[model samples]
Target: MDASSGNSAFNNSVAPLEGFDKDMLSSTLSQTQALLEHFNISDIEKILNMSSRTVSVMTQCYCSGTLREILLSYKSVHGYFSLVVCVFGTLANVLNVAVLTRKEMASAPINRLLTALAIADMLVMLEYVPYACYAYLVLPGEINMPYNWAVFVLFHCHFTQVLHTISIGLTLVLAVWRYIAIRFPQRSHILCSDRRCNVAIGIGYILPLIVCIPSYFTFKIQATVVFENDEMIVLHHVGLSRMAKEDDELLYYVNFWIYGIIIKLLPCVVLTVISCWLIKALYKANRRKQALKGYTNCNSASLLPSEKRAVSKSDRRTDRTTKMLVAVLLLFLITEFPQGILSLLSVILGRCFFRTCYYLFGEIMDILALLNGAINFILYCSMSRQFRTTFALLFKPRMLAKWSTPASQTDVQTTYV
Candidate 1:
């Protein structure tokens, strides 16, 4: 090649790269490394080291890799398996939402409150839970695309927290509504209505959203807090990345206590106390009413035995609704009450004391919360015969059984909550 042509070609095409001799390339690489050193992620190295400790832990969990750690990281098989299992939860919650909202509940305040809860739970399951299952369990370690990260963070901070809090508050609302129904049935219509119940449900969501806004600032990727003694705290907490100071950790935990007390404990305690009172009142009223009924029956015993059976049937029908509400309250206590008591226990005893038994205990309790969403449908179905008739009407009007079944008056199941 001519010297002039070679010179022109070198300068024109490779001018920017002409300086990258071995020495220059080495210098450039060193400079780039210096910049990366400032903000490089140590997440993968730390995670790999932590996985061995999972053997000592009770709630063992591990990711396949930090996008590169696990060999089978991107397999569709794992995704398929996760989808199959988590889909069950999604299906169950959807059924609950559909049943509660679709059924035409009788015009009662309790029904109104329960209807709101059903809708909220439905929104929760549909919107947040499925994504959570995959993000936390199914995905390759530390899935960090900007878009998915944004979606995951929003679900964790806003949708999941808001829905769970609202569901609990709505449960309390249902309990209080029942208390009013039982303790002041005479004034119940005046004090509680579908419209008023609607307002309360709306407020329940608004209050939780106000609290969870802080969560948006705090909530981050799920993490573990292992103490010096090796007790692992495996749940979601505020992101440490956002916290500027080391001392702020104390404030983070304190914030949890505040949220727990107000959102979980206070409401449960209040509802439990009120529920006891309502149950007592219901029992007493039933006793007195039964005694009077017996007295009337004795006086007319000689005159009309058939009429006595008729009265008994009517009384039974009316009490049916009460029986159904009792069942619902019992279910709530079974699922939710344990969770509150366990929270208090964990705080007092500390999570490590009992050999990490608290983690399992909490998991069991979480199932109850899950079931809270699950059983609303069942409660509605078993209680209001009118709801049954109406649901049947909506789904299959042509198959309608003419005339509702004779609901024993004592068996008059109406949603009090």
Candidate 2:
């Protein structure tokens, strides 16, 4: 029976197995043991302190619960929601790429990084659209996918991950660069130069893929035959590799350490720390600006008008850029930090948590990431005046021309970040 149909069976058969009735529990345990043996499910003894037999029974009962049914029910809903979000986000990121890469905007090193980020985010959304359509929109029983399509599915899995990881890396670098620009403006020209930013962006793309290479071996395409509508059909899907199936410890460590710590947890922690530093630096800079303003007012006759205006303009631009980046970093924390924590918890809590909690909520996490990827355009539009002006100039040049004055044109020419 399909998962939805089995909800009733789950309700009736699994609820009683949770109680302390010895006879019923014993019968359920016996059946679970037989099922495990039939399926050749290994590593039960390593998961918990309980006997392998009891663990097997408990795992079976745990999976066959209300939570599973609820997750199953939401599957189609998430699929439809993700599809819409991906479509919108893809277009948004495309716009972001076009706008950020324009000559006026691209002069800023940060904008170049933003351009790379937009490309990565755009690819992520574009790649997910097809997968979402197939996996969620299409009915499983009706799916007659070719074995070769599994290659795309596999590529989709790895590619999205590599891209997302690159996004995370780029974000971290962005934060650090912004911090250096703000905290050490004197050295920023040397430290945050175009060459350095270009190298950083290249590393951001390449390093993540290198780190994710081992993960490519964790799953393989497995083909199976099924009888459908009185006809035999072959279907292919992703399954655990021989190494993954045989070496549970290796899989656990790879997931727990490599994915959980290095990819998710480490980046989240570093970003959080760097974000805090950025905020602190902004505060100090604000105080300095206030002090300088007071001094300028008192010494109005002594200071050159042009020099005073220059200082004020530079300060204002720095403040705006820092504030916008802080918002971006905050959004990243909101979306990514929880996933990192969940990854760690799933590893510690064993397969049940991994399947029930982590795997069940996978789509929700994906949608969150996609939103983060797509929402950058909105953030840039709202927070960065230069971005907005440039966007208008690019797409609505005639409209901009009508409003353009020499002063406003000069303001546009002066880089924002």
Candidate 3:
């Protein structure tokens, strides 16, 4: 009975009655004929044409077979995949927050930004669950709840845009922080303090909220016509307000500049420039270090043990952390750029412009963004030795307890003897 095409009784129950409209139209026409002379001929013609067009559109099915297949496939496969990503991504980000918040790592400027990034990613992932349900479960025609869908789209769209913007902004800040730290080491402490970084992160979240405030008022639910099994069905769809729809051109341009430029393009441009400079600075520093190899080796014995170890460990960790962050920045750019481009096109060219390909591509870009958030922890794990060690320690406390047991201690004593 739940099947789209296999239920005969359900289809019959929804089918139109034969001669029903004809009988009603006969009575209405008979009554209208009595007042035909009172009405203008042109007005009558307009009314009939409007009715015909409305009927034609209502009886026409939207979305093609291939599009339905794609939707179904995405719902069955990607929906669950996205669910997994959100769940695991949330856990990973929680662990990232836990590990980075420890006393050992908490005070550093980069760690502060990284912690903020984890929180932002976690919020985005949490928001993804409803969005995935909207796109995959509800959109595939399994459920019909237009009002709920409209309300959720309003909140989900705004919250997601804000959270995603914050994540990107924090990343941009991180890149700039690293650039200053490496290229201008003396001023790094002054320019990139924890207070300043926190302020920047705050601005990152707040600016997006201010920018996306208009969305809350612009969207509304509209009744849309569709045909299934030759039966006309009216469904609710989310659309812009009457005012915005009337002045759609202006709205498109405004959104293109506001959402496209400020939210997406600007951060991308900043990150790219900063990333390039960071790379160049890193390369130059490596060459300089290589040139100082023999001099450093000769002077090594002249320094205290702690000082030598600190310098070596600090330099290596700084380079690794910077490189890891740069990788995250690059991956974010790759995953998110498409959605920004799509937003501009969707607004300017109209949502119906791409048809099936539009939905397919939009869904793919969304998944990519989700993937970007989901993999940040992996980047940290792979790139930072300290992160890996800390993560292991946090997750494997029982093993450490076993290593400190009396029998293991006695074994160590026997080996020393």
User: Which parts of model 3 are misplaced by more than 4 Å?
Assistant: 1-76, 138-143, 225-234, 345-357, 398-417
TM-score of 3: 0.74
Tens-digit lDDT track for model 3 on 113-214? 889989998988887787666555445433243556645654565567677777877777887878888778789899988789889878877876777655
Please give the range of 10 consecutive residues that has the lowest summed lDDT in model 1. 1-10
TM-scores for all candidates: the values are 0.63, 0.81, 0.74
- Among all candidates shown, the one with the greatest TM-score: 2
- How much does each candidate deviate from the true structure in C-alpha RMSD? 15.7, 8.4, 12.1
In candidate 2 the C-alpha lDDT for residue 167 amounts to 90
- Pick by lDDT: which candidate is best? 2
What TM-score does model 2 achieve against the real structure?
Answer: 0.81
Better of 2 and 3 by TM-score: 2
Number of colliding residue pairs in each model: 18, 0, 0
The lDDT of each candidate is: 0.48, 0.68, 0.60
Model 3 lDDT, residue 178, Cα: 80
